[model samples]
Target: MSTTTSETGARVVPIPPPLYYAAALVGGVLLDRVFPLAAAHPALRVAGLVIACAGAGSAAAGVLAVIRHRTTIVPHRPVATLITTGVYRVSRNPMYLGLALLVPGLGLLIGTWWPLVLLPLTLLAVTRLVIAPEERYLRQRFPDEYDAYRARVRRWL
Candidate 1:
């Protein structure tokens, strides 16, 4: 899957991280139908909304930063720029972080427990399947700049 684009062509991952999150959401929804594990508490539902909103805000900030820098947003395409401003200052993987928050937040909003349970596995897959390769590509492409940025920013916050 990592060979979807090409090492020289675009440095794309085999499967995009968003698909992992989306699959988790769908799987969780299906599992909830069978298991019926609800979020239970109203407070948890409220928290879910807040967390989901924060996740959205984080992802959007990252997107806006990319747009401001005129960089490519698709992970399956070449990264024309190495962004280190806006949300990138706080977390190198803000969009991924947002998905992390969003899935479980949505699970809670929908009164299901399966998505939260599935999150860790999804993140693990993403880290290995998507982020690691992207980081390697960035390191290869940007060298000193990426190293400095990697040192300055956390991967997830």
Candidate 2:
């Protein structure tokens, strides 16, 4: 979903995180096609697959936790609850963290360096374009509760 202003229902997250990650993955793969930087070993590629799976699992767990709580998963949307259980207990932004990990893993799995190379930019974009705004909204909306949660949980782990 697109970001909305404070006056509208949802507010401040500039873009959906999935879109950022997807673009990174696709762009990186395309860059790999042009640059041709293949992984050096077969084991590394396998490792990438494992990492990708783990990332997928983590992201899925986060999504499930949100669904179980019956809250909106959309970053821009107004949150109904402060999710501090399940996947959220470990990281405040598990879904983003998962996708962040996933993009690089996919790059390695594909035997290329571009995704890993592009990962930093992906993170920068996600943090600035999505997470930062969402955090602002959360802190503004939940104040004391969000502060407590932030105090205890790491942003990413």
Per-residue accuracy of model 1 over 22-140 as CA lDDT, tens digit each? 99889999999998988889999999999999999998888888888887777756677799888899999999999899999899999898999999999999888778878887887
Instruction: Report lDDT (Cα) of residue 45, candidate 2.
Output: 86
Worst ten in a row by lDDT for model 2: 3-12
In candidate 1, how many Å is residue 44 off? Answer: 0.8
Candidate 2 runs further than 4 Å off: 1-10
How do all models score by TM-score? 0.91, 0.90
> Tens digits of per-residue lDDT for model 2 on 1-157?
7544332333445666798889888998888778888886999888898889989988999999989988888876667788999889999998988998899889888888788888899899878777777788888777898999999999988
Error of 2 at 4 (Å): 13
Model 2, position 118: C-alpha lDDT score: 83
Sequence-dependent TM-score of model 2? 0.90
